[model samples]
Target: MSGTGDTAPGADAGELPAYAERVLSVAELIPAGRVMTYGDVAEYLAEEGQPEGLPAEGGGGRRVGGPRQVGRVMALYGGAVPWWRVVRADGRLLPGSELRALAHYRDEGTPLRAASQGSDDHIPKIDMRRARWDGRQDERDAPWDD
Candidate 1:
């Protein structure tokens, strides 16, 4: 779908792919001081059009995408949003942008764990347990349950 229309949050409708628009919208929903893994964002979007308790693959809606697509969207169009909040599942800071992401994390009070003494980069890792956000304001309103 190509059109010169406005979409959600950070992009013009035709400027980005439909899936990319949805991906960025989810990224924007992430609360400050919290984060979601790439897979989390993808899974969230995939489930958005699916029926309750149904697997994404079984849903009749168009396939949104997966972790790699999310990463690609972020890498290409994430500069204008809180790109740092979408992270690796293992909690390591994004490579190459580690210092930049760390600054934002510190500013937002995102939970972080000290890197082990022998860690390669010496940058602190995000404390995934404490910092991961489920993108739900309340359990009852959640689109899907674990």
Candidate 2:
């Protein structure tokens, strides 16, 4: 986990740290045209030391390590994975890499909101309501809660 940034996880006879590996694994599971927030990724992995009072099942658990740590792992060791599939909570593209990420999103047919005329930079955004993936069964497919 300490080297030139060009090397990908397991690229040079080395492996990513355990937590980072888990994070990248979850990133890989995000299907094409869908996305997960950093927090969602953390919850999906069920990392240890989750905060209290959140349920362990059904994606109600508090995420472990929070978003910044997840971002760090992605920055450090995520080049080989579909790094763009992990995104901000608000569904905005990653700063400094927006165009590159948007290219992937377009190619995958991820839903997007066309930029409004009044938008600060007129940059399109992810249509999160239609595109968010929580690593769970579709609500339509789940049995009724009752």
lDDT of 1 at 2: 15
Q: What is the lDDT of residue 106 in candidate 2?
A: 93
Each prediction's Cα lDDT score?
0.74, 0.72
Worst 10 residues of 1 by lDDT: 1-10
lDDT of 2 by residue, 15-87 (tens): 6566776677778777888888988877666654433432354353434566778888888788878888888
Question: Each candidate's TM vs. the true structure?
Answer: 0.76, 0.74
Model 1 clash pairs are none
Candidate 1 residue lDDT tens string, 53-97: 333333433566889988888877787678888999999988777
Clashes (backbone N, CA, C under 3 Å), per candidate, total: 0, 0
Question: Against the correct fold, how does model 2 do in TM-score?
Answer: 0.74
